[model samples]
Target chain A: MNEIMSILSYTFFQRALLCGIAISFSAALIGVILTLKNYSMIGHGLGEVGFAAIALALALNLPTYAVSIPIVIIAAIAIMIISQKKGEGADLIIALVASGALALGVIITAFTSGFGTDAYNYMFGSILTIGSADVILSIALTVISVGTYAFFYNRLFLVTFDESYAKARGIRVTLYQFLIALITALVVVIGMRMMGTLLISSLIIFPAIIAKRHTNSFKGMVFTSVFVSIACFIIGMFSAYFLNLPTGAGIVLIYMILSALSLATTKLLKL
Target chain B: MSLLEIKKLNVSYSNHYALEDIDLKIDEGEYVCLVGENGSGKSTLVKTIVGLKKQDSGTINLNIELGKVSYLAQFNLKDLNFPATAKEIIMTGTQKHGKLPFYSKKDKEVYKRVIEQLHIEDLQNRRIGDLSGGQKQRVLIARALISEPELLILDEPTAGLDYNITQEFYKILKQLNKENKLTIIMATHDIEELANDKPRIVYLSKKVVYDGNYDGWKGYEK
Candidate 1:
């Protein structure tokens, strides 16, 4: 308890904790919709795209998340449109874009001298470096995410549940699709800054899936996922502080442990 | 009164046309059984009527309010396991009434009335996957009927049901058509089974091949 308090005495630690909770909430919320819609990999897919966006931002000496958000959001919506046209082979489209973007980022990294080390920071993340700017952005994100969700919650439920039926009722299915993709892109970009491109998708994938095992309804799953995500983030941050571990890796490890335990409990109890 | 009129409608995908030069008209309180074979355009026609798919080149004239046309899509194998409950699913039907969440007094009334009307108050909280085939169909039908639509469009609604359940479902549709005076356009591959219901058949195979009552459809061929 003393150690955690000491860690919190530092402003950087305070920023990291605050930012992490905000990101986790939005990540889990978007995660439920993505997982239910079978778009889980879109997180990882956007992560790879974010990598290329970061590289481009670095090349132009611009702000990373700022540049990454628009590029990733566009890619997210484009992927959705292509998937709609291509039908159920969305996995293939996501794989194609992700691989292509990762390759492009890698090429840029190879060409830029003395930049590989900085890129490495983004790959694994350095959450201890969280600044006031990041904290402010995260808080803003939380407000936007919650507001967007509240405004469109019913329409989103209809689109996610029965898109064709929703469309037939004169609901704008395409517009909702765009809104989900847009929010997903925002969360992925912001999360990548704190958790890195490689591990951020896990934040979006694990909480909803874990919550799914425990909850029965969509609303239940959403609330449970947010709870699980925030809990995991705080615990994982504490462990990282105490054990001298990387925050991203520690959080993901905690997620894995929770997932295994959930599987085991469900199997044994037959619940 | 004509509820829907499709004039020279044509819908096509990449390689070939799914529906072509289709012309049809539906009147109020009519029960239309759209029968077709595999790869035929029964699903396509219904989707077009509901405006889910844009016609390549044609006109679709809907005399009724757009919200008055409810579409109950074919039951998906994947969606059966989805996490929505019967009550929640039924509430989604209220989406056409407005986009915001159900906060109005009238919205609650519609929801309560639909469940009571369907006699599905018992299945309200049950997961959709837990319901029997007939019960699932019942819930889906309730969803479509919740908006008090003037016309209901169902795509292969009885695809996976047992014979008895299918008969019971047809009886329900018959009741809706006769009592509520609701117009219906149900797409199905089970022509032989539907023959017993004796609805006005519009046999479609990329185009309208036949449009007549069961008596006139006695010896119709592809």
Candidate 2:
């Protein structure tokens, strides 16, 4: 407890906690919405786009956040357009886009060679990388995520449950679809820095799945996912600090354990 | 005044016409049953009326400016695994037009009226996945009706139900149409079943093959 309190007293550790919680909360909300639509791969795909955007920003000597955000948004909209076809076409488009963006990032990184930090740091995530600015951005994203969700909760529900019904009711299905894609892109870009592009999507996927195992209602799923995400992030950070594990790895480990436990609990409760 | 009118409408997918030069007009408080074989565009016509798909060329004038529509899509069209209580699902229908954060008091009252009308008040809090197939359909109908739509459109609402249940379902629709003066448009391929119900049947095979009296339409079918 004394050691842990010392870690919390550090400004860097505090920043990581603030950033992680905010990103995880938004990621979980976005995850539940996308998972309902069977578009979970969207998070992974957006992460790849985010990586490429950041690499490009580094190459151009521009601000990473400004450059990465717009590029990811554009890519997200493109994915939305391609995914409008749905089924095999949608899956193929996401796969193609994800692979292409990842390849582009790798190629860009090789040419620039000016990224000051090790690419390994971005790949696996290092809590030491989060700055005060990142903390602010993450908090802003949380506010945006919560506000967007609160205002559009019904429309999002209607769209996710029965899109045709939403369309027939005169709701702007395409607009809301774009809004979902846009917000998801924002979450992916911010999350990629802390959780790594390779693993950030897990932050979106795990919480929602874990929450689903524990609850049977959509609202319950959303709240549970948010709770699971924040709690896991905090515990994982602490575990990583104490046990000498990677932060993302520790968080994911905790998520995996809870997932298995929830599955078992659901079965035992039913029995 | 007719609640809906479609003139010279043509819709195509991949160079094949789903609906070709379609002409349709539905009136206030009238019940319309659209019948066609599979791929004959019964679903296409309903989709166009509800504005899901835009017409390639021609016009659809939905008469109601407010034009509130309650749509119960086919069973296969809805994602039943969606984790929402029956009440939450129903309440979302009323929240689309600027009612935000949560359902309002007026929304709650509308919900009460719909559930009382549908008599599925008990299923309100039950998870969607837990409801029986017939019960799911009832909840969907309640969701649609809670909006107090000027027109109610359904595509194969009776699919996957037993014969007795289908009849009972239609009986409720009939009562709503007769008593509440609600406009209804339903599309089904169940020729033998719905033809006996004697609603105005518009038979379509990519176009209006027959319109008006089902009695005369039977001769036309022969």
Name the candidate that leads on DockQ: 2
Runs of candidate 2 with Cα error greater than 4 angstroms are A86-89, A114-116, B77-80, B95-99, B219-222
| lDDT scores of the candidates, listed in order | 0.84, 0.84
Candidate 2 CAPRI level: medium
Q: Report fnat in order of the candidates.
A: 0.54, 0.60
Residue A198 CA error for candidate 2 (Å)? 1.4
Q: Candidate 2 clashing pairs?
A: A218-B83
lDDT of 1 by residue, A17-114 (tens): 89999999999888989998889899998999999889888877888877898999999999999998768567788899999999988887777633
Q: Give the alpha carbon lDDT tens digit for every residue of B57-99 in model 1.
A: 9998999888788888667647555777888888777734444
On residues B37-143, what C-alpha lDDT tens digit does candidate 2 reach at each position?
Answer: 89999998888777787779989888886447778877663555568898887887784443354766787898998899888989988888888877878888888
Model 2, residue A134: distance off in Å is: 0.4
